[model samples]
Target: MLRAIAVAVLAIGIILVALVEAPIPAVALTAVTGVTILLLLWPRSSRDSVAPSAPEPPMADARAPIEAISDPLLIVAGSRVEQANAAARKLFGAHVVGEDVRVAIRHPAATDRLAARQATADQEPIELAGIGGRDNRWQMHVADLAGDRALVHLVDRSEGHAAERMRVDFVANASHELRTPLAAILGYVETLDDDAAAEAGTRKRFLRIIRDEAWRMQRLVEDLMSLSRIEAEKFRAPETAVDLAGLAKEVHATIRDAADPRSCDVAIAIDEGLPLVAGDRAQLSQLLHNLVGNAMKYGRPGTPVTIRASRGPGAMVRLSVEDQGDGIAPEHLPRLTERFYRVAPSRSRSLGGTGLGLAIVKHIVERHRGRLDIRSTPGEGTIVNALLPIAPLSSNRNATVTGPA
Candidate 1:
């Protein structure tokens, strides 16, 4: 009776573990566990007792729990794979069930731990790369089971590792970006305090340099903060209906009002009767400003930087900014949206770019559940397009927003 209770307890434990970790429903797990317990602890007839020498039923029953886990798990005994769950077979291969554990997991770190005759102080979770595929990463945890058996669980950590790496790289890049302008400001201030201040012209130039550096730093900080806010709210979609045509005109007016030389070259060609898009009004305004601003900065002087808005494929509203400038090389196109990535870092800095324009635009588009595309030819020019979804229950209306003649 005690033996039956132990078997019942084991079955219940497996089900509880599966309920916690596996994707299977709790009610389903409970029902399955009850059935499994009955089958494991039920009274055996004379014929079933005679078959006890055939195989160990209790141990075989334990395989159900192992298979319930989504992570790859293995039961290694005597340095050989005694049993492997479905996930393990899918990752290492179905043939790994009877293969040597060291051969099954090719990583040196995994091999060393799996091959150890006895538990040592060096036992810890092993990070294995290139296990399932190149760029794949897994955390291998080994727990010694009874009867010389080992339970090896592999959890995929590729995404978490990638996020951590991006975080580190972003910090380093931001520090360098901020440091450069700060160093410039400090050097200019020191020069102004010394012999350079004796000359009025030189002092003015030095002060101008300091002011520009300070403004650059200010812009960088603002962009960084904006990026953080956008990322924080990325998971929540904005449902506000935004009029694309009016936003385009507002951005154009703001650019023209600044009285910059490039403002004259800016052109707006928004389509008539364009529908409202589902987006945050402020973010969409910023997106337009970034795209159009990039165009004005990069496009050839006196050439048109056209901003066009019209209906797009499906339920999307297409907004594009076309610049007549030296187009980007194909190789640099893919990484353009990455923070601090620039085709010409020096030129970008000279034009007052914080290097976060496209990155912010990318995140903004992602938050709105839209698509962004950049097309360029080396000699012709580059065009950036953002397709945003039309707001539900919002239809096109007759509205006019025109740029300067």
Candidate 2:
């Protein structure tokens, strides 16, 4: 603007001078004055003569470390979402950049916190439920990067909350199971000692009650330990070849000899030449035992408990243990693998169950990268299907190849 005005004033002065003086002298005078003015107005290249460049942002360096984290990350400058990492882009979309932090996040609590004067250390993390979709849970953690700047991290807490709930329920159920047996054992033992004149028949019955209660406690403890071991090993896949059909035969025979007369007949109809499954032998055996035993225990009196193995697509083997008995309710089927859950708690206990059978089986199947399915009809029977991946051909060479039933 200044340069344009200077040029205009020089032109006007030249015109006024030309009107009052000779054309030759007026042109010469205009040229000298314009040249002098141009020399004075020209910009210099020295630092003192030039304008300063914009300063480097202090928080620019802070983004690299936050970007390295796998969780969603957002860098906020006052009310604006100045920067966002890849995860944040995936979660909230690319429009998050340059937008207000409150609008980008859209959660009231999170926006409120971002608008806060300071992010205190003791402030609770903001929980964002059903973000992106329902059934998803996220927790937002904010850290003060600098004045009016913050680092926001989003962590998925769905699995964490579920694990916590399972843990709490497990402890509660375990306590209840043990307390019942312990109370029974203590009460019966006290009765045996106090009744000196009790008949031999009465004394024998009392002793049997004591023994049963004690054994129930022992079995519960064993199952709890087994479940702990199985869960600890769930992340580590098994490599050993386990025979589901053979294991089923062994369990069937054992149950047959010990089964009550009124109990269902145990039948093993698995394929004899099925491919071996990649799994731990002992855990697989326990898996078969639990399924077969549950069938026998829960099946209708005098009905057949059928055990069958078949080859499936994708080099997988399926082991099915079915019972023709009072089938489980539809609602109960979903939580069948939960620890210490029972369709009929009294009946389950009376039949010598620890209630951890299905839970342990579930963990064992997971460790082997296998899938377990339970299907039942109201008036019919229940069938538990265990689908395990077949062992690699090279893994079973020169080894006792077995598969899950």
Evaluated with lDDT, which candidate comes out highest? 1
- lDDT tens readout by residue for model 1, 102-207: 8899888888877673657447788999998898889887766544666677878787788888999999999999999999999888777777437888888888
Work out the TM-score per prediction: 0.80, 0.70
Q: What is the C-alpha RMSD of each candidate to the true structure, in Å?
A: 7.5, 20.2
Worst 10 residues of 2 by lDDT: 38-47
Query: What digit string (tens of lDDT, one per residue) describes model 2 on residues 1-405?
Result: 654655665565446544643333344334334423432343221223545563324445434433433467777778899878777988999789899888888888787877773835646778997777777789887766434666677777777777777789889989999999899888988898899889999999988998999999999999999988987766567787777677777777777787467333888787768988887888988888888878877888888988889996677899888998889899999999988888888888889999899999898887777789999998899999988888984253324322221
Question: Which regions of candidate 2 deviate over 4 angstroms?
Answer: 1-70, 80-139, 145-147, 199-201, 262-264, 393-405
Sequence-dependent TM-score of model 2: 0.70
Candidate lDDT values, in order = 0.81, 0.75
The pairs that clash in candidate 2 are: 242-402, 242-403, 243-402, 243-403, 244-403, 244-404, 244-405, 300-325, 319-405
